[model samples]
Target: MTKRNEPLAELVTEAGLSEGGLARRVNELGQDEGLQLTYDYTAVYRWVRKGQRPEPPVPSLIAQALSERLGRQVRPSDFGMTDTASLATRALTYNSDVPGTVDTILELGRTELKSRGMQRRRMMTAPFVLAAAAGPSRDWLLSTLDETFDQDAPRKIGMRQIDGIRGMFKIMQEMDVMRGGGHARVTLVEYLSGYVLPLVRRQHDQEAVQLALYEAAAEQAYLVGWMAYDDGQHGLAQRYLIQSLRLASASKNKVLGAHVLAGMSDQANLLGYPEEALALARVGQRGITISDSPACMADLQILEARALAALARDGRPKGSVTEAVRRAEATFQHVRPDNEPEWARFIDPAYLYGEAAHCFRDIADTAQIDRFASESAAEAARQHRARRGALSQAALVSGDLQRNEIERAATRGQTVISLAETVESSRCIETVRDLTKRFKPHGRMPEVQAFQARAGQLLKVA
Candidate 1:
């Protein structure tokens, strides 16, 4: 890799600024975002001469500073730090080829393991861009699966190792459900980087063993993506999920690929992209055999219902929400616990009811909200899943508020807060926040005001 800063030097020269002048400008720009930087000429000199990379937002800030100086649009790539700095940017993209996608995932995993600050990076909920997913979805749809996975090397891997990986993923997933991804997301990424990546990278003689390894690797990637999602890193989660889809396709595992797409769809809907979410859900449905995985089928349909409900909330169409809900219900009836994948084990009646309650709530269907939310709460408690229970209770608060039952809603709101007090889930926190928003019209009342005070205090502590 080249360790030169000729481009930055040229840009600095073109702007007609000395090293001290550039540093002052950069610091002034940093102040706009409440950053107190005391950079001087030496800092600028090292960046332009020694090929040092500026910290994030700083790179963008540098671009902004130069853009203002040059009176034009300048990007970070123009800084001549492409070899090392560009890996992070490239990691977010869904590349067209499998090897390129694998490279992106590997680079991201390595960074996440090496840098605590990167692991702690706040998950920005940027508005969903439809174009971002279009090409990846098309590539997955049109690509042909590999007929054989044979390799010519001495290092042999077998099914036992693959099964061990799968079992570990299941354990990690259980941890995710109970404690949320905040608890173990970083550790899991480290495991993927240190252990799982090498196993898949090794050569194997048997095609079956190789496929199994890739399938296990894909599942691990999907879990990593989900952890990122739960930790609020929406864009990073999408990139990991796209890589999971590519790996699953390489292994000739359509059901697993469909599951990855389902996750992407969920992220899209959660971040407020109903159209793209619904389209991704439909893409998950294509080429999946019904008998192969009933639970996954139900999960995809329910996600489609979720996207439809979101569309209704945006005032696009109302009828599709109900119809989608019905389809989800019908599909869920076929879920055979004995035949389902372990990853989809959580997609039982309680989960479906919780999702349905949100859908009905979105379309302002108070009757369905009452019915589904109540049922979800009942089943969630029976299943010992506090996160879902809290969410359902929050939905009940929404339902009660919709029906003008202020005291009942406030009481349920308190229950959600109590249930979520010990959990580290942003989704649960946001649920309570949404319930608070629903109480805005009745904020003057003492019961609602008391609930508001308690909820705010709890979240502040959390």
Candidate 2:
């Protein structure tokens, strides 16, 4: 047995208190905090003789009791234990009015991105991640309606801010499609830190502010889930995605909420939880229907089709795909919004087409996949080269249709790794790996062989 009568015991002795007396004082303090404690002489004896640690709140109460009795700042550490100082400090430092606190959070996020092997690091205390994940929603829900940008306030934001954020989001999405979430994990975190965090600091109308916060929170949770997904932490990823959904709800942004739900569905499908994926996708579709935006509705429908296809729900998937196509075409027929949210603008006909192709591919519907994939490929070709990752996905589906093993592997592998270099989501790498796995059984294909060799070499160094 370990010795317990150490510094805390010494302190109690110095205070001229019997073991029963110290326990009584500590129990009284616990009552003030509405904590019921069964502590008595035996508990005090256990602390003194066995180094017994009290549960949460009890430690603070003991410290408080000691401080009051001794007339000094008696900390937990003073009792021969390390205090939970970090949590205490975080609680004390949390300030909605202080801009510096926001900067600090951004800086921490940046540091996390820059650290080696950060994406692979599993959080020891899951509650901390859960707490942080819930923060954006809580802030949005409780924020005052009077909060608005000051007209005379300095324009701390600029066009570059918007461009950088949109660019990163696009890049990450492509990387995610091409490789897997694993490869793009770090880039996503960097984007969250450099782009999303700063935008969160900007002053705006209550609605705008909430919307921005929702996007940031969703993106943050996306990255978090992506990392967890890459590392095979399904439960953690699900929790983050759920928290993201709550944040989106708090913002009253139905479209974004649908997007988050779709992402969660994707993760569910990936983990072989097909029923859960279908359920989440249906929820996303309902949310989009309520959103009343044709573009948003189409995007959600496309996501629903993807989930249903994963579950091999033939009729539902086909109907959802048809509806998505019709809705997306209708949305594109109209003039696009001039001041559209950057993330929303990406959810157009091309996006829906690509997603539809993916759904068909999941269900092994080569004919439908080929048709949609070809159309999406043509659209992607016309789009900017920066969107090479998205185009590469279309190329992947088409190459699969043509049975061009070498070209498919080479193109998919190149685009995937290239995207991985820029973004930090491991999902991107996993996507590429999955493609490569499909060709592994047929090892005779020289191009597939070569691509695998190259990828193996890259992994050794990476």
Q: How good is model 2 by TM-score?
A: 0.55
Q: In angstroms, how far off is 419's CA in candidate 1?
A: 1.9
lDDT of 2 by residue, 1-462 (tens): 777658878888878889888888888877887877778898888877898766556666777778887898675545744223232233223244434334334433433443223221422122323233234333433342223323342212234544466566666755654455566666676666666766666666755544556555555655555565654555445555555555555445555666666666666666666566666666666544432455555655566666666656534445555554455455545425553344555665456677777776766666677677667656655764223344346335445734654556465556555554544444445555666576676577676687677657555544
Clashing pairs in model 1, backbone N/Cα/C closer than 3 A: none
Best by lDDT: 1
lDDT of each: 0.77, 0.56
Write candidate 1's Cα lDDT for 1-462 as tens digits: 436598899998998889999899889988998999999999988898888877766777777788988998666656743222445455556666655666567666765654344422432332234566766666666653323323332222445777688788888988888777677887788877778877777778887787777778888899998987877777777778878888888777777888888898889889888789888888878747566677787788889999998877767788888888888888888888876767888888788889999998888899999899899999888877788899888888888888898999998888899878867777877877787788888989999999999989877876
Best by TM-score: 1
User: Worst lDDT window (10 residues) for model 2?
Assistant: 118-127
- Model 1, residue 287: displacement in angstroms? 2.7
* Model 1 stretches astray by more than 4 angstroms: 1-85, 116-130, 144-158
RMSD of 1: 8.4
